[model samples]
Target: MIADIDGNASVSNATGKPLTKRGEATRTRLLEAAEVVFAEQGYHEASIVKITERAGIGLGTFYLYFDSKQSIFEALVIDLNRRVRHSMAEAMAGTSDRIAAERAGFAGFFRFTAQHPALYRVVREAEFVSPEVLKLHYTRIVEGYEAGLARAKESGDIDRRLDPEVTAWALMGMGELIGMRFLLWERDENGLPPAQLDERVFTAMTQMIDNALAPRREGNHDD
Candidate 1:
């Protein structure tokens, strides 16, 4: 089964009918293939033929799932967004506090980004291929982040003065750029990103986050 933008179970086909287990598997294959094709070749250069070829599925089978290239592209964006957020949430699970959650969540994000560098390329191209999905991607991530930050603020784990919405965006932007600069840009002997983010970079980044979010003590005026 596939998930819609709202995280509901979705058929993910033009027919809107429930898919059998095998059908679900085929749709997943197409999406996986679409990820690589869209990443390697931008939207304009990518074609349904290319995606199907990569999937090793028949060309006619493509339309059964998606009516057009744009539809699949949009679906792929949502799919990637869901998976990445899941990675972060999974890693943050069982953490004791917001600070710990933040570190674990970011570690999860970087790990996924390292494994799927195509995430960066595909999402960036979404701005052109499908602007709405691009917004949805970022908004979905921020919604969860803002909710977490809001809870922390209420519990005195973070600065009460900080607006959760704004802070969420700021922190998300920080993570994206940091990953792009370090993990995405750096490559190993095999020309692949390191399996994990650098310890030094992660420590420095988390320190900055901690200092910014940590609660202010009484009578401490060091702004």
Candidate 2:
């Protein structure tokens, strides 16, 4: 799970010079190619030539956007993180409340995961290939999530006892594992992951979330 906190893409090239429209497009092409190549071949096996070949760009052109394979790999992680966060935010838009927002947001996440299964592999590889980017990926998602949870807590929409930061990480972990099981593991007869998470699993997951986050009643007591 990842999201761009700043919502800004790089406007310059590797040399610290502003990129022209064409240059930006080429950079995007390289990043896109890197995403697939890295996902398919682990960082140890992936090469600049492979990425350039996949992008149909020359070897020399690759250096203009990324100084090395590691650089491009890091960039791809950020790119995927930004895009996935955007997908969640887009789905969450106009929801009535935090609970609704959670449902929509998770739905968006699973949808993107289905379309871009590379996110899981590439991110996992980042743990070894570039630990810092891996941290950035999770931190970015949790930052936004914590902010939202804090707002909900202030509004009394969620359990006041819940620590926003802790709850945010917990919920993110739940979503991550659930997506891995239902979206990444399951396959159709066509040998592709489902286009969306199963409604039954979604319902069960949300019910659990609602139970966890719902405010406690004054008279309610549990041993």
Each model's lDDT: 0.89, 0.86
RMSD of 2: 2.7
Per-residue lDDT tens digits of candidate 2, residues 100-196? 8988998999999999889999999989888888999899999989999999999988888889999989999999999999998997887688999
Q: Could you give me the TM-score of model 2 versus the true structure?
A: 0.93
Per-candidate TM equals 0.95, 0.93
- Pull out the clashing pairs in model 2: none
Q: Can you write out model 1's per-residue Cα lDDT over 109-164, one digit (the tens) per residue?
A: 99999988889998999888778888999999999999999999999998888999
| Model 1 steric clash pairs | none
Q: Which candidate tops TM-score? A: 1
Candidate 2 stretches greater than 4 Å from native: 1-9, 189-191, 221-223
